[model samples]
Target: MNEFRHVTVLLRETVSALRPRPGGHYLDGTAGGGGHTGLLLEKIQHTGRIEALDRDPDAIAALKKRFAGEPAVTVTQGNFFQAARLFPHPGFHGILLDLGVSSHQLDTPERGFSFHTSAPLDMRMEQDGPTARDLVNTLDEPSLRRILRDYAQEKYAPQIARAMVAQRSAAPIETTTQLADLIAAAVPAAYRREGHPARKTFMALRYACNGELDGLEEALLSLFNLLQPEGRLAVITFNSLEDAAMKRAARQLTAGCTCPPEFPVCVCGKSPRAHSLKPVFPSPEEIERNPRARSAKLRVLERR
Candidate 1:
């Protein structure tokens, strides 16, 4: 746990959105390194409790060790999407969902999340199930292209997919560096110079391998529904795909009057369930301190 160093992103901004109180129960959905969990605990005092939930085994271990013997903190290991089953007694005052990989995961080379290292292509956060290596070595070219295009919006998905299939046919694409270099060479020289061509491809593969975006809306709604009246749900997203999902969930909850304009009168009687707070972004100073925080955005919604 001591080595699990992660610079908490938008720490104050995200937790402050929750507007914690001393006796109100809350949840830290991502709980990586327990950064958000710690801040949430600080503001909440000792009256109520918080559940720190995470999907990664490493994070779960770290969180458990960090908050050991603390009555106010209950560390749980599992995806927050199933939070309903995890915490059956709802009426949560606030809930947070920090979406994306943590710095610890990327910094640890053997985890194979970053292309900077030459480790085996294993991006499984749980350190279980299928890995990036499995997908890259097994999936057909069209499937690979679709993953790249849909997940990361990679413009050169076709070329990259073709290159991966061509390279893997001769030998298994078993390493992060192998895939990264192949992607670098497959794209145009100009695109290569712009940035690492493998960045998007890697992101897409990780997202697919982990099923990150799958059923995201349903999960958000489930968590939101757990909130008590006037309770808030704050979410921090790193990628456009995740941000878009957050936006859709917020809109769906806050939407009202389902009847069409052509009807000229309400019929279905639909009304807003929740309302959003102003979205927050990292400060320039925060971004300079940690470049990864630059892409982070915080959105909060309070139940009606």
Candidate 2:
């Protein structure tokens, strides 16, 4: 827990953009360690309610412990996509989506979220799900290649996928070290020296196994619908794919008149639901303290 308490990226900016008020209802979609939730609960005052959601059981437990005896807070152990079903509502005043693997996940070797750590190759946000090993062991070469190419944006995905298929025939790819080593060996020498050779491959496998990107897309739409008129939504993304999705979704939702150009009468009648808030980022001081914050990007939207 101490490790996770270090620093959350764009913490102040994100919270400020949320602008929670007394008695306002709020949701923390990725309540990892309750760091941001704790702050929100404090700012929202005792009357305000917060329905915090996390898919990981351990994270939920941690949050419950951290925020014990606080009736204003309802800790839920489930994906945020279920927010609409989890609670009956006209919609919340504010919603926060911190979309990235938490520091706890990266620090814990058993979680297998980091290339520096040699664990079981499991990267599911849920404690129990089809792990990286399961995908590597069972996925055919073509599926593996597509996952790497599409999810991780790896250029040598096909070659790496082919290599993985060949290597697994000799032995089961059981551990993080095994897969990392194989990926490192498969990539070109120039790329190998630039960064962890397994970073892209691991990220791709984790996304595929957890269905993270697709889940994010669904969650974003659900969240938009769950905001009260003039309510606010904030999302923090750690990767290009996630950031791009957020950018596009924000643009589409905030855009007015979605009717086709030929439809001069505006038959589609799609009015803008939300307006974009200035995207947030870490201060130089915060980034210096936590290098991981360097990649984080925060986007905010206000329901119209």
Best by TM-score: 1
RMSD of candidates 1 onward, in order: 1.2, 1.9
Q: Per-residue lDDT for 62-110 in model 2, tens only?
A: 8888789998899999888787888767479888988878778877888
Report the lDDT of model 1 for residue 236.
91
Which portions of model 2 show Cα errors greater than 4 Å? 1-6, 259-268
Q: Which tens-of-lDDT digit does each residue in 1-304 have in candidate 1?
A: 3388799998998888888999989989899999888988989886698989999989998998899988999988899889999999989999998888988899898999999999999999888999999999899989999999999999999999999999988999989999999999999999988888899999999999989998898899999999999999999999888989999998899999988789978998999999998999999999999998989999999999
